[model samples]
Target chain A: MAVDDAVRTALEREVGVEHEELLGEISATLTRRYAAAVGDSDPLYHDAAYAKSLGYANVVAPANFLPGVICWSEGAPYDRLREDGTEADTHLPGVPAKGVRVMGGGEEMHFTRPVVAGTVVSRRTVLLDVTPRDSKQGLMLVARYQDEYVDERGQELLRSVRTVLLR
Target chain B: MTTPSDLRVGSALAAQTNDTSITQVFRYSAATWNTHRIHYDKEYALKEGYPDVLVQSHLHGAFLTKYCTDWAGRAARLTDLSLRVRRFAVAGETLSIAGTVRAVRAGEERRALVDLDLVETRGSDGETCVEASATVEVPRSWIGEGVLP
Candidate 1:
């Protein structure tokens, strides 16, 4: 079977199935580094004292910080990764571990609560659907994944439906 | 200090220019643990038909989020953000982002919900890289005259 067909079939079958992962805690360093990398100098993200002044126990992460992280674990061995450097074991189910080029298409996010440093996070994801369209480059498969990120206590932090384009 | 009184449907937040460098791209990739070669390996990027390393889509999200949060400051909270990547941005490019108020609606507890339309344009060709929208929840006091109508 063509690799593309296999991906499409797998994606279709995987739709509606929920996949969950424990994304670990939101650390002060992770939040700080992410904020710094974005060149954001918001004191609420930098100073614990300032955050406390605002009633937070610790620095507050930028709203999209949790989903912005591509990998929470150490990741797969180099040889086990795709040519594009993405892990074969990514949260994205159905898509082959290799032989596919994947890129983020877009994202829609709703922030339910402010995430402060030290909050443990987990995410539940499910494939929503897939559409095949001819692109200038070639055939492209567009997939959207619904994700709900929750705090350790099961309270929701944010929800997003992100689109990924694959070839 | 922009307060709630400054928001209006036709008003636009100040447009700001963000300059990205190769170093910045590398650092952002490292900070996010993104191992994509298209963002760091210039050779790989060239092979992929891009001139140089490309910017991460989430980085674009960060830029748009920053624009809204900076404008809202302490008076408002960013409740929702959505973005669609229209084009790819290469490293060392200057990106200009501008947001205009789209609508105003009443919120719970004497609050107001402000919707903003945003666009990120490339400085080199003036091409759009991403288009986004955001909703902010603000105290009713932030509403400007005619902003509700």
Candidate 2:
């Protein structure tokens, strides 16, 4: 399935429109689990005392922790899932819930501050742009989404621009 | 660990290797709440043209993230990272990450910002699977003057 006119129109309409979600508080356990999953044994990410010794309030999250997480809340029901097993209600804004295939192309991230346990976080996402390209498989649309993560006090934590390819 | 003062352009960081397994892939998917069948269901992956359950894209990012942070240690902070996946590696493939200092510049509060060009290549075919770059904030005291080459 190639990117058709409707998909292009939908994506174009979402450009610059911000979608907000509360990602909730960061937890030390979750951070540790994420680090363990990545096979990283960095003490700063696992030991609170070690983290504090290094001047952090608590164990710090890995650089890509925020963006690496796919869903923040309990995911949608089975019916709300796309054929590719992605939740239809979040992430990609204007893209249709069905028919289109989505793949992660790449991302550029700026980690402004270390995320520590007990810090409530929120994310504001905006569709940056969409470009049409031809691929061997067929027509592909490269859509870029920019996500800004902040603590409850509105202090920036991390900012990322992620590219998704739609076919 | 390579301190900032000792980090001259073209200096290579120690290489880190990760031997990925199907179980590791499954655990990563569970931890991230990712239900994408291509990461766990070999049959589904085969239908999608992959030989076996494929590694998640974020997992690749995770490995690269670990590489940078592990090298930077506790004091140095990883400020920026960018990654592009050029190829696919299935579960059970050995992935090796290595980096070289590209540039060094001054930063706030007596810190030096080091830029590194990084690459993650698969062991089986020796093809580059992911290309990346990172910026780390390290203490200026650690970076000696005239380090840039």
Candidate 3:
């Protein structure tokens, strides 16, 4: 599971591939709880009547709630997380890096619409781009991944581009 | 005299201040399903050369949104927000985000276009780490009314 030149080459070559993941439905209560945990009291995300007035069945999930959907793959080739809960594997497939740390820079989110409650949302992830960088301390890699959220009717709810620094 | 009519392209807005801690970041991580190693794993974060598990990017973005939406009041809707990362912001660092009115015009039939400069400054070191721009649509009738929007 150690990161090596071979892993970097494989990740670099695998760019532009799309990974589709189906997320289990999180209850509406949990959805609103997430918003509350962030101290967001926006009625559109919590008040059923308010969301119903906006033509929704229940509360709509906040725009930044997409990351709660990643279900870890079982038997994936990546190293199993250690007792310390740290996976020593630096080179994740679709992410290019030989050695160094990976940090999430941020995301650019475009909301075409808000998410509706009671309906399970699906994620369509695509490895958009990959680039290499050199730092004084060590080598660095940048991976751009796009996650698109869709509702039951296949309408695009939101699109997020997650940028991470791979070392 | 800093009303919408007096706003100019180069004019800057007042800064909004906020302090975020690791505890808040942990709560957000638990709530948002963000299992990224760089966010909460100290060993992983240090191995990656970061000072500590850093604040989630979306959380930082949320703070920036709060800065504008709180100022814009209820009569405004953020139409478009676009930002590029200039530097990394870690936990325990209080951030100050500011918005400057860039341009104002009629966007749609009942909406006024309000463009702003979104900036996040580190409260400890006073360094600007993020730069963004956004366009908001504010109702014309929101002014001078105690009830916003």
* Predicted structure with the largest TM-score when compared to the true one: 1
Lowest-scoring 10 consecutive residues by lDDT in candidate 1 chain B?
Answer: B1-10
Listed in order, the DockQ scores are 0.87, 0.77, 0.35
Writing each residue's lDDT as its tens digit, candidate 2 over B49-145 gives 7899877888888898888887887678888999998888999999999999898888887788889999999999999999999998888776656
Query: What TM-score does prediction 3 earn?
Result: 0.78
Candidate 1: where are CA atoms >4 Å away?
A1-3
Q: By summed lDDT, which 10 consecutive residues of candidate 3 chain B come out lowest?
A: B140-149
Quote the positional error of residue A142 for candidate 3 in Å.
Answer: 1.1
Q: Could you give the CAPRI-style class of model 3? A: acceptable
Task: Compute the interface RMSD for candidate 3.
Answer: 3.8
For candidate 3, write residues B1-149 as lDDT tens digits. 13343444555767776677788788777676555767788887787567887777667777766566556654566656666677777888888887877766665666667778888988878888788877767775532233223
TM-score of chain A of each: 0.96, 0.96, 0.77
Better of 1 and 2 by lDDT: 1
* Real A-B contacts recovered, model 1: 0.79
Q: What is the C-alpha lDDT of each candidate?
A: 0.91, 0.87, 0.66
Candidate 3 clashing pairs, residues 3+ apart or interchain = A99-A167, A100-A167, A101-B48
Interface RMSD of each: 0.6, 1.0, 3.8
